[model samples]
Target: MSFQGEQYPGVKAPAAETDGFRLNHTMLRIKDPQAALDFYSRVFGMQVLRRLDFEEMQFSLYFLAKLEAGDEVPEDKARRSVWTFSQKGLLELTHNWGTEDQADFAYHDGNAEPQGFGHICFSVPDLDAAEAWFDANEVEFIKRSDQGKMPDVVFVKDVDGYWIEVVEAARMADKGD
Candidate 1:
């Protein structure tokens, strides 16, 4: 009875003209850029790809990603901006200028009572190892794999209280054709 096999009635197929379109990144508003950047780099091993600052607008955008071995990242900022947008699965953290200075500043983490955005996820090669690493890093856990019906998935909260689902890639269901 799972919806996985269902065709999602009334949903039309996307046009071939949209073939080149891609999901560049998901943006999350963070109070502190440095804290978020450090967390992503230290825990998720993401590197900042490009940073855009809008001074008059009083905000900044930072794009981050885990580049593979063969990926060629340009040294030029302009080229890097284009290259960053071309890749998929990048995480963008937006910071409104003075929010970090406000001691009580907080963003609605989507999982609260009026839920909207769910979560971002990462596929780790080893679930057990990831759990251990998270423990060592003192990552806050919403759900441990062994504690839930789903035994291979783990949910942890980031510095800003955004839930991030972690899973073992090998256990993911194949997209059957």
Candidate 2:
């Protein structure tokens, strides 16, 4: 399939290579664990599914997920660990010790001059409500939904300056038109 005069090769991957494979999570380096936790939990309703601390290494990993209604997290650590790995679309936050104490500390949000990573996205049930909540909470926005060419979408920043794109799930049905 091609769009906008660009040809897209119809590529196929070996079934064996993709059969049992799933994307586990995407990791983001955070300077302050508490701050990052607060932002993700409060803004996106993500819960910390599991926390792994490497005290000897002076770092920690926090796995977060947005649990669905009536879904319960496994109580057993082993089961929870397995479940966490089995689930798709998880966010992992890594915190290196002592970073919070530094007066001038910030993570490379991957959207600077030589941008590498772009942004994480959240599909909300109501984009307008989400934007309003963000505004009321004084969340920093890189681009407001109404200001963009795609008026129904929003881009906001987290405590560590990572960009998060917010869009209404209903918009997906519209195909951006």
CA RMSD per model (angstroms): 3.8, 3.7
Model 2: residues >4 Å from true position, as ranges?
1-7, 174-177
lDDT of each: 0.91, 0.89
Top candidate when judged by TM-score against the true structure: 1
lDDT of candidate 2 over 48-136, digit per residue (tens):
99999899999999999999998778899999998899989999999999999998999888999889999999999888889889998
Candidate 1 residues lying further than 4 Å off, grouped into runs, are 1-6, 174-177
- Lowest-sum lDDT 10-residue window in model 2: 1-10
- What's model 2's lDDT at 23? 88
Total clashes in model 2, counting residue pairs 3 or more apart in sequence or in different chains: 0
lDDT of 1 by residue, 1-177 (tens): 345344677876668898799999999999999899989999999999999999999999999998789999999999999999999999999999999999998999999989999899999999999999999999999999888677778999999999999989786674235
* 101 Cα displacement, candidate 2 (Å): 0.8
